[model samples]
Target chain A: MSLRNALLAMLTSQPMTGYDVYKNFQTSVGYVWHAPDSQIYPELRRMEQDGLIRGETVPWGKRGTKKRYSITEAGVESFQAWLNAPPEYQRERDPVRLRAAYLEWAKPDASAEFFRAHTAYHAGRIEDWEEMIAALRDQSNPTLAKRIEGKSAEEARRITAYKVFAYEGMIARARAEIAWAEKGLELVEELERRV
Target chain B: MSLRNALLAMLTSQPMTGYDVYKNFQTSVGYVWHAPDSQIYPELRRMEQDGLIRGETVPWGKRGTKKRYSITEAGVESFQAWLNAPPEYQRERDPVRLRAAYLEWAKPDASAEFFRAHTAYHAGRIEDWEEMIAALRDQSNPTLAKRIEGKSAEEARRITAYKVFAYEGMIARARAEIAWAEKGLELVEELERRV
Candidate 1:
């Protein structure tokens, strides 16, 4: 459902061929709600079938034709409804934390490596999200710029602000994770020293 | 697979009936790797079939017999293999952040309500994690006590420390979420005021 809504949101900016959607999604909404090309193609077909989006065959490179998808009024309504509704929270299913709780089962070096990897993963995410926030702030992001085109100054501000806010939230989380993992590294060293 | 590992971790403490596993899970490893009784029961059966755990018929309440599961040596080796391996990182698919990025599409009041719900939900989780941390600190948690029963002082300390560390990570995340949502509420107010 989130993937469907993410596609709908992408289309709200402009109708795009499936390739365009796949390409642009990596640089935009894909930061928040990741869908690989595998999921994106099938979801586009389903959304077209469901009438949330209308598809038309459009010219591609040379003799090629590709299906371009545009959000219908129904798509806009569905996206709005999802936005207005209370977000459903999933229960905690954190695999890292799960392993953290049982680190006694892991060798000391393995435990240290685990936290280092955790830190490295989130540090990379922070870099991606920071790049996104920069793009949103400058209105340089292609998707965002398109979304804000023809909108009033106030409307554009609102749009850009929320997107920036969302990316900031991601940055904050990634930073927290890095901090926790660093502490985990310290804990691993301390535990090994005691042993 | 995580659920299977979580179950194996639980059985490391002692053999238990499926009912006991379901009950104890809600208070212990379930915090990090949540699974409903529906999934737990079937996974236990599968673990038995796969030789990761051994199940025996035990007398139950006078007239009935129930299957109690114990972790086999194979289970411990599998769990250790998982712990020693680098954790797999899932790409970001945060529904809240996705919705946050599009809050401009929502009504002002609805946006406010969304942030409120976000705050309340994580606030509740913070409370749960805090209580768990307290339990772990005092070795008052039944599962922790059982796990450390025959351990040396240093071994017990490692067991307790890792569990505490895990719960603290959860609390840290919940706090970060609450802070983000509070900022979101302020953003909503500021956005609505300009309108």
Candidate 2:
């Protein structure tokens, strides 16, 4: 359901061929709501069937034709409705936390390695999100540039600010995770000393 | 697969009936790896068939009989393998962050409401996790109490410390979320003032 809304949001910027959508998604919306090409292609077809998006046959490279999809008026209304509705929170299902609780079951070296890997993973995510914030600021991102093309200066600022804000939230989360993993590493060492 | 590991973790504390597993899951492992009774029961059957667990017919109240499951040596080995294995991280698909990125498309009030709800939801989770930590500290949580039964003082301390650390990680995440949403609320107001 959220994937459908994500697709609708992507189409709102401009109509794009399926290939273009797949290409552009990686640099833009995929950071927040990831869907592989497999999922994206099927979802686009479903959105078309549901009348939330309209697909047109368009010229591609040379003799090729491709289907380009644009969000419908209904799509805009649906997106707005979803945006306004109360957010549905999923129950916690964190595998890391589950592992953490039972670190007693793991060898000390394995526990330390687990925390190191956790820190490294989240550190990489922080770097990605920080780069995203930079891209949002300078309007170097093609999808963002397209979205703000005809908008007023204030509107463009609002658009850009929201994206930066969203990415910052992701960065905050990654930072928190990294910090927790560091503490976990220290705990593992302390436990080993006692043993 | 993680669900299977979670169930194995539960059984490691003590053997339990299928009903007992479902009942106790809500308070302990359920917080980390949530599964419905529908999933738990079928997985228990599959695990027994796969020799990860052994089930015995136990007399229940009156003329009823119930299946009680105990983790096999294979189950212990499997759980240890999982705990020591490299963790698998899911790609991001956060609905809140996805919505956050497109706040320009939403009404200001709706945007503010979304942030408020996010804050409130995480605040509630923080409370739940904090209580869990307290329960772990006092050995009042039935599962933890059972797990540490007959263990040495040092063993009990290590067990309690790891569980506390896991819940603390959860609280840290919830705190980060609350802080982010608070900033989001402020951003919404700032944007609306310029309108």
Candidate 3:
């Protein structure tokens, strides 16, 4: 989805100033989808002009101007339409993958160093995701927890089961990559000696 | 990384026609990075003017003209610089996340349908990734397997460990999403009943 769509979706939740929207992403939406302040502000402005949303200033007694935004009926309709439409899969362009593609470039002496760096980075990143998986698994968010509470026990269990499986998938992929890098390091070291 | 960078990196591997590059993505890079042919050809034409790469036409009987491209020294150096640079964290702007963000708009009944669709789609995707993980685990690629032959057992094991971890990471994330959707479906249904 475009950043514009994400901004519109956030506004539908509740009216918020551009700053508020930015904060919401950093705190809540940020975990699942990330966008920086740089991208968000420009998109907010553009969306306002497009009639997808409107801005209203709510001035504080002793504060600067804060223009809050809410989705127009038009915006909500557009967002829903966009959601139901077939999703276009964008390429996953990751730096780690690029490094792997260029693995043949590693010189003998640099092989160990490259592998070491990659191993360290992936190791740390995997841990962070694992932690996120754990927190999410708990259904700590009130909206999510309450939703879980409302379901029939069997239904809730089915949903919970899928979530845990997704988390495990991530963990499994991370472990796989780590192993590849480690093996690559060994191969590089051996080639280094021969070359 | 942008599509531009991906094209550049692919050229660094070998001079390839735009068609060849697109095919390469399908076979080798599709798992980690993907771009449609529409994006690739335009990028090649642009990169040519920018001096990042140069293309030469080769005639093939019966087939249309194909322009093969080779990365310039500058392109290679630029790609290397990008490798050493800090990774850019792009948010996963998934349709599932978008739906979650606007869940309030969904009638509990409608929400259940949305969640079911998302859960099924993600579950299938997770399964696909699992197949890939298994294939990689097999390590049947002759070039890569030969490279690994010389490594000490400990080093080989470490590398293997890293690869497995990364694979699990992706699977974990996928499973987590599936779980969320399933639970969300039930919650939506309950909410619908109340309203």
The best candidate by lDDT is 2
The C-alpha stretches of model 3 lying farther than 4 A from their native spots are A1-5, A8-14, A34-54, A57-66, A71-92, A107-195, B1-5, B8-14, B45-54, B62-65, B71-86, B91-95, B123-195
Alpha-carbon deviation at B176 in model 3, angstroms:
5.2
TM-score of 3: 0.60
Give the per-residue lDDT digits (tens) of candidate 2, residues A70-157.
Answer: 9999999999999988899998899999999998999888899999999999999888888888888999999999999999999899
Ranking by DockQ: 2, 1, 3
Worst 10 residues of 2 chain A by lDDT: A186-195
Tell me the TM-score of each prediction against the true structure. 0.96, 0.98, 0.60
Q: Evaluate residue B61 in candidate 3 and report its C-alpha lDDT on the 0 to 100 scale.
A: 75
What are the DockQ scores of the candidates, in order?
0.88, 0.90, 0.17
Question: Which candidate would rank higher by TM-score, 2 or 3?
Answer: 2
Candidate 1, after superposition: displacement of residue A173 in Å?
0.5
Candidate 3 chain A lDDT trough over 10 residues, lowest sum: A161-170
Better by lDDT, candidate 3 or 1: 1
Candidate 2 wrong stretches, greater than 4 Å: none
Each candidate's interface RMSD, rounded to one decimal? 0.8, 0.7, 6.5
Candidate 2: pairs in clash: none
Best-fitting candidate, measured by DockQ? 2
Candidate 1 per-residue lDDT, tens place, B111-137, comes to: 999999998998888889899989988
Candidate 1: DockQ? 0.88
